[model samples]
Target: MKTYLPQIERRILVRPNQTYGILNYDLDNAYPQRMLELVAGSPTAKDCWNKRTKFIAGNGLEEKDLGKQIINAKGLTIAKLLKALATDKALFTGFGIHINYNADFRITSVSYVKFEDIRMGDTDNAETADKFALYSDWGRKTWKNIMRSKVTFLDKYNPEPEVISEQVCKAGGWEHYKGQLFYFNPEVDDYPLIEADSVWEDFETEAGIKIFNNREVTTGFLPSTMLFMQSRREEAENTRPDADTYTGINIPTQLEKDLGAFQGAKSAQKIIVIEYEDESSKPEFKAYPIQNNDKLFETTERSVEARIIKGFSVPKELINAEKSSGLSNGSEKKQAILEFNDNTAADRLELSETLAEIFSRFYKDINPGKNWNIIPVTAIAADDNPGIKAGNAINELLQSTLPRESKIAALVYAYGFKQAEAEAMCL
Candidate 1:
């Protein structure tokens, strides 16, 4: 005797396509594109991704003027560039920046490149990749044909002035030479896994649950049922001209038309009627009652949502504000913001460091030193008195019978006021 059991296995493979001269991202070179679709289709995943992106970007750079300075001819500012990079980093755990150079071998303009549009060039060594391939329609569905002219090959970012000058000279000019691409993938793999990659199945499950509910609603929440009817036979001369001769009027077809009329919201709750000749030939309407799995679906959706949020390392309070209690909502939200900021500190730091290194070489008027930093949104949140409203606290303090000194002390200590300022206000 033999017993069979189902086994499921998943693997992430990086294969090189010699024709394209690029290493495929997870067998198809479309992992990032697939991830984009998955997030687009799933509400929870999209929410988590958005929240992660926003948190990572925070309030933009510490230097307001520097952030406002345009980086490219398109008027893309440093702040906008950072946000775009944060969006890709939150989604793909990687991002790419396209850098152009002038005749003097100096950086001229920088633009944000979509992470999904980039592919690492095929290389014998795993540690280094010299070239990067960029194509907008990797799916090949948008355009009739993806011609060689549509694909651009870019050199990996090299900071060495000598290398850039030599490459520019060899290519005959700066315009002829391809721009350099700054690819950031901190995960140390051929390609970075998406932030929510571990819970991708959960994303699919959540999307499936939504589709299931949509189908159920569209069908008026009807159970799967089978309709059986005895065929009506008539003499050959009695059959109508338009009737199906062999089936004698096609009762099943008529029944289907009648039943289809009752589907969807517009025709819901309408009575269904069937006529038969006698008890022996009565139509049997057998409903295979589908068990009400609303609760099961709800549970599964919640589980999948939780898993996706966890995979993104986003706090639950941030995504679903209603889940937190009304009394402690503010405090809980503040704590969640702080926690999320801490979680994304590394991401912000990486972006900040990369921008700092790149901008240090930019034109002197725009570059604001090597200490480029992005302020976390938590800085603003931390300053908030979440536990107690300041107006309410002041009202309570004023209405109390406490001495002036005591009130002033409370204001200084509890409300973060300077002692002199608190005393003057109390007086």
Candidate 2:
């Protein structure tokens, strides 16, 4: 008989730094689609996005009539829809809106399509071409689920897969392709796609991938730290020993075995009894403690979290991150918050505009040849920094030797009111 020994495995580290070949990404490929789906489906990510969306949209629609339209859409609420749309854009850089209309040429509902389930053909828009092609796997359950069907299990030998269906929207009617049903909408001819950001696309890079990566790294901190053993203890004889020596803890073999037996037991308290071979000698206990080094981990976690917050353009203070500077005072912190809001203004404006366009199109489709305008979603409520500054200026003017009319004029200009109104208030 021949005996064989297990092969020794060696760890190898390869430095491919800046030497790898570029990888290409397809806009229509499933990788990006799957990634976006994961982000949208993740409960944590969903919550973060929902809160952020509400923060941007603030409460709900500013217009009462527009709010009514959203309420009528039963399945989805205005706030929830905005949150989904914002999350879609944040993760996929683009989102789709599907407008549903009633038979009387009135918009009855509005819905959103996840980027993953959307399939677009050669046409730029889904509704533009008379016979434009668009596919949605909304109700199509995976083949694996169908294969294990209790009713069809007996037919496993001849498992006939269900045919995939497609729908076509004609000029003013509907058509089905391979079991798909589509209704044509002549009022609007576009797929209502909203892109959150525009940037260069290359083989190894994407618009939102960096942000998602940062978020992942930030969230991994706790799990990674869980692997760190924070402390250790050693028991040794009462005699002094040289610090540099390799002497091990002095414990009797039997006593060590007993300690090992308590590996995973948990109780309110534990007592250990050690007996010495010398009947006259008493057993004593002492512990030499060791602490784990975690400065690197703390620094890395904070750095990653800051990067994540930066990617979202969210204020660090909002998330309770350590203050960037020593400014612990409220006024100083307010400035930081104001700066963050200012930096986010552009992105918020873009989201509002995108939402406005979708709502406008829905209104137009609902009421053809009617003059109606939908109010655009407002960005985060304006900060009162300007108002505070105006008040300070007014106080300064009052302290000066300027005439009453001059003060009133300054107040009128600063507060955007008529001179008479300012005088009346000042008086």
Model 2 per-residue lDDT tens digits across residues 1-427: 9999998642221121111111112322234443445435433333334445544444454444344344234557655666666565554445555544333333344565564444333233233222212333322335323121221000001111231111213222322221121221111322322221111121113224445455544444222221112122334343555634646645445555555443322421456566455534544444444343245544544454444444455555555523222113344446545665455445455556655544553434432333222233333333446445655666677678888887788766655655555676456
Per-model CA lDDT versus the true structure: 0.80, 0.41
Candidate 1 residue lDDT tens string, 1-427: 9999997654467897777778888876678878788888899999999999998898888875777888888999988899999999998888999998876667789999999999888886443258888999886668766565778888889968888887677667866987799999876647878888888988888889989999988899887888787764532343566555555344345566787988876678899887767898887879987767988997788889889989888989889875432234266677888888999999999999999878877755575355578888753353355444655667678679999999888877776666666787677
Report the Cα lDDT for residue 7, model 1.
72
lDDT of 1 at 136: 93
Error of 2 at 15 (Å): 28
Please state every model's RMSD to the true fold in angstroms.
11.4, 18.3
**Cα deviation of 53 in candidate 2 (Å)?**
3.0
Deviating ranges (above 4 Å) for candidate 1: 1-10, 125-129, 143-146, 231-254, 272-282, 369-371, 379-427
Task: List the pairs of residues colliding in candidate 2.
Answer: 166-180
Model 2 stretches astray by more than 4 angstroms: 1-52, 71-74, 101-107, 119-261, 264-293, 321-329, 361-427
TM-score, structure 1 vs. true: 0.78
